[model samples]
Target: MSSDVAGIYARESPYLDRYVQVGIAQGRVISLSFPETPDEGAESEHDMLDRIESYLDGVEESFDDVQVALTVPTDQRQVLEAVREIPYGQDSSVAQIARVTPGLDDENDDDLRAIREALTENPAPILIPDHRIRDGPGSTPPAVVDKLRSIEGL
Candidate 1:
């Protein structure tokens, strides 16, 4: 976590039917959450928020340009980076992700497990778009995944 930060922000999301919260540091997204209640006095205006709103509205927005600060281990980070490459409104299987992930033996079951674990531990859901994964939603709520996929018309 950088010392310089814009602080956490929150906004009610009609698509998810929850309050979306984000923690930002040095202009990079560090955390994301869907809370039942909004944080008091939390800032509600951010470029990311607008992007998410637009995406939920079926704009086919791409989050590839968004800067995200990840603190996972090297292997998981590599897997996550590959997951991020899954284009908007599209999906990839865990095997496919493992194949594209750097330093991984796609034929190995352990590598496939690693990909699943990385996605399950994803720090930012929509920013990373783990819902675009085909097999499952990792740790993201299944309903959220369904909603996201529905919005994407997938």
Candidate 2:
């Protein structure tokens, strides 16, 4: 059976957009993209939710879970909290690292927040290709390609 996975993001960064794409057949991420331009004018939260829902509808079936990777650019602490409150998974791989690392004076929960924030906050474009189905010479960083291919559990 096909599965569904959605990644919803709200970013003000000029380099990113709100669109996301993922692999549903095996619970793996394929790629993510954001519109180059932010939606202008006043938009209600419900309107934003509807937009996100439309993006997720591309999947073949109802997703087992919905995940959001939103980014807030201002003192929108309330928005950040709201994003966290959504019934979905928040990427915390970086956060977990910050939690376990011994204090060396340069890292903390705030640092983790920064990293996670960058995922959605900075508006950087991220494209995750389907490694199993696509390949090209010199298309990806050598180190990254090596690391991904070496993973035993990919």
Give each model's whole-structure lDDT. 0.82, 0.31
Candidate 1 clashes between residue pairs 3 or more apart in a chain or in different chains: none
Off by over 4 Å in 1: 1-5
Each prediction's total of clashing residue pairs, residues at least 3 apart in sequence or on different chains, is 0, 2
Q: What is the C-alpha lDDT profile of model 2 across 1-154, one tens digit per residue? A: 2223223323332111232222222233223334444335312233233433443332222222433233444433332332233222222244333343344112565654543443344221222111211122222334433433333123
Best lDDT among the predictions, by candidate number: 1
Please list the Cα RMSD from the true structure of every candidate, rounded to 1 decimal place: 2.9, 17.2
Cα lDDT tens digits, model 1, 101-133, are 877876898888888899999998887888989
Give candidate 1's whole-model lDDT. 0.82
* Residue 72, candidate 2: alpha-carbon lDDT: 45
On TM-score, the candidate that comes out on top is: 1
